[model samples]
Target: MRTHFCGELNKKNLDQDVTLCGWVNRRRDHGGVIFLDIRDKKGLAQVVINPETIDTFKLAETIRNEFVLKITGKVIARDNEMINNKISTGEIEVLANHIEILNASKPIPFQLDSMETSEEVRLKYRYLDLRREEMQKRLRLRSKVTHFMRDFMDKNDFLDIETPFLTKATPEGARDYLVPSRTHEGGFFALPQSPQLFKQLLMMSGFERYYQIVKCFRDEDLRADRQPEFTQLDVETSFMNEDEITSLMENMIRGLFKDLGDIDLPNEFPTITYHNAIKLYGVDRPDMRIPLQMVDVNEIMEKVEFKVFSGPANSENGRVAALKVPGGASISRKQIDDYTKFVSIYGAKGLAYIKINDDGPSSPIIKFLGDEVTQKVIDLTGAKTGDIIFFGADKSKIVNEALGSLREKLGNDLKLFNKEWAPIWVVDFPMFDEADDGTFNAIHHPFTAPSVSTEALLDNPGKSLSRAYDLVINGSEVGGGSIRIHQSDMQKTVLKLLGIGDEEAREKFGFLLDALDYGCPPHGGIAFGLDRLVMTLSKTESIRDVIAFPKTQTAACLLTDAPSSVSKSQLKELNIKVTLPTKN
Candidate 1:
């Protein structure tokens, strides 16, 4: 149907005749000559129909944007004045001798080039939206990233294996997307939140190295970076330790970005333990690009007359920490008040601060504090004349979370980041956490292996540490995995600690527990969100931009008007009832 892609026609084909079939990007009539900017997946080419080709000229005059046209023309050099230096094939234009209008299109709802177009309108007409050059390029890059991942994994002897989508749901992390069993009455199968369990079972079955680019579903609230259904680059291997897995995965990503060429990421990503991350940055996943770190001032604040600082300083489950913002005295009262409100979202009762004026300790709270206490705080935090100190005090959780979040906010607000890439491994996480009910829950899941020295079951559970590790890229958790409990006793112990008694554990995860009993090897794997990965690589804020068709915030497909009401007859066939009135 065509001689070549539109973007492929260049200086080499200046005198060659060719047939180009594409959508008319635009049609311009100047004097008696018509110029059609024809576009296909590869890109665009200009086709000129002169007055000499009367029929072709007449047909070209009727063409509009998005009109599918077949054109046969001879490639010729464009006039120097007419040359478009911006385009790759700007030196040449095809002089059309014949034209065939294959299809006519209606006017688009909105122009593709306009930045002001609303997201709702774009999502509703997503097929047309995907035709835009930017979107086309993103999809192409996504394909390339996946291809690179597969090639890397295969070269490392990882088998591309698949797991079941409809499997029994266990309490892992998120709510499962439940699918009603139509063939089996009243039963349900839940969509996998991940292939976490199955991949571990694969190790027991003796598939040492495994990988899969698989779809996963979670029933959760939506956000810019989240979707109800998403893809993951799942990888797992047997008998390999954390160091080995980290090295392999890092090399894979390094090679991937090398092919990308725009940004050169670090070869060695730093390692931060869970405890150190909290102590230094107040967050488990710290953005290394940011220079600011949290400084403890609990001992210094203990003797202060200011009850606000002193009360929390000496109490259990309380903290006195400060963030020393470099050159922060320039911030206004309005901005400080705004930041105070920001931290309140994380349960921070108040945000205390001291602006380091030439006079020193200049803050509303400073008047209530003793001189010794003020000197200790300044000394402890190494507060300088140009720095501003922000403090948080309360429960340990509130102190760390609020201050941690504020650190990230200030980095963006103050533009204090280095603007370079920083990736790291967050390791040595606690195996169990005490829930609000005073019961223990697995921090990363029950199957995770306890560190060698901490593997004692039913005794010293509090001191246990998991072999889990998270791959953090610029403060975002990209992927996570842990060595699995190959022993059934350890698996049972972890489950019992999670408050899932034998009966319940057997009901929900009997198959997995059974697999562990039958000679399971120690295996671990990581799963990266493909959509989020592609978005990060493309430097896009919204994951929806990279997805071909994405649901709205409420998880409704605008293009198809999905989650619509089903007919009563169909509902009866499934032995279901629609009790509530239909929402219009």
Candidate 2:
């Protein structure tokens, strides 16, 4: 209980008596005079306890870092020489008449401001870690982000509606986290991967515009940007086409950036088709900031005698492509080997290159290509004197993955970004990808509407495109959505193409199918990954930094020691039995 925040006092409050309660950030001593820095969410303020107040001085002397304290003092101006220009309260100090230690603290395991602390230790002591100023600022910004989202949605007549967290499991791409039923034996409810179906159902239910800031779960392998559980800004609307929906969503994002970070994103984000994005940049979500692009050398290499390039170039599913890195001829042999190893992780067999030197082209494979063919490659790629052309020759999948990833890595490693913020819309994605066994899988989801009729789609499913679109910022997909197939027959047709039999579809998605029959309107919506958006805005590398309680890379919660066993009696009531895989 204090009259004023410790950091709020400045020279204007000089001679004003105040009661400030906070933790002792630091304790200092000059001769016999004792000084303590009191800190709270606002910031820090220095408190001076002189021997003139004997009891307060004695109490202040015992204070240590993180010691919670309540101070009764007078705000006084600091001497000009004693002024600290770094902090807001620097122009003044609190002359304490009384000091009360609200709580004492043991020595902290790590300093809050230290950068050298391991992420494991920080996560283990997440409560203490969150007390750091940087953590406080980030969480505050997160609150502001949600506030702005809600306000914008409300202004646009979007209803804040909720969907079930414990629901039936449907095929959404990843494994779902299931909750065992106690009342019903052998029954389980899966956590929602997203509110995709429910949101669409809402449109059918006549709630034209619906939105929810919701939690979703997936039992999947973890990465820097992924988590076992994450948040999504789920939205759905009725009677809006793809163009109308994208325009509105773009405005929301543009306003968010300009309002929150004072960063002005483009009014109309550049658009790229899925086919061109893959062919030119090797990835659908291309970082336009990177100037590098993949060049197709299939025709040029197909005639060459070198089997390494000619072999893949001649195959139907194979590709021969080159990435021309400007001024990359200066890279050393060891660095080139390192890049080759990097691409190998993406199933690339090897990386080949031809460096354009001032004297002419040079490479180990130049002898294989011959002088005539080598010159053709140089001319085809428009290779300059100082440039290096890195080639990928393999199945199209491997080539795209290897070269796409390498493009991003080189962009960062070589500082080749052409702009700071590059947002683009990747559209016209193929409706389905055919497996080796000839079965089809939906590229986005089965519910996504195809651009062609059901019969047309069935005729050539591989070439059919979806109305789906994704919003990408700096190569990270922030949001994605597509027009929905409101017709029940169309929905079932797409499901059929995905190898889902009628009985299986009825068992899993009967509710959605049944709802679609009841006069559903033309509708579509987008879901933004809230954690990824904040991570991008805050310029943090990992989603964990933005989350309050995040699991480790292995998806274990260090703080709670979660995924622990329950009592035997509790398991018996749930009718569950434990099973463990034998170690090799």
At residue 453, what lDDT does model 1 achieve? 41
Please give me the total number of clashing residue pairs in predicted model 2.
0
After superposition, the stretches of candidate 1 with alpha carbons farther than 4 Å from their true spots are 358-361, 452-457, 581-584
Task: Give lDDT tens digits, candidate 1, residues 313-344.
Answer: 99987898999998998899999999999999
TM of each candidate vs. truth: 0.95, 0.98
Candidate 1 clash pair list: none
Off by over 4 Å in 2: none
Largest lDDT belongs to which candidate? Answer: 2
Model-by-model lDDT, in order?
0.87, 0.93
Cα lDDT for residue 412, candidate 1? 86
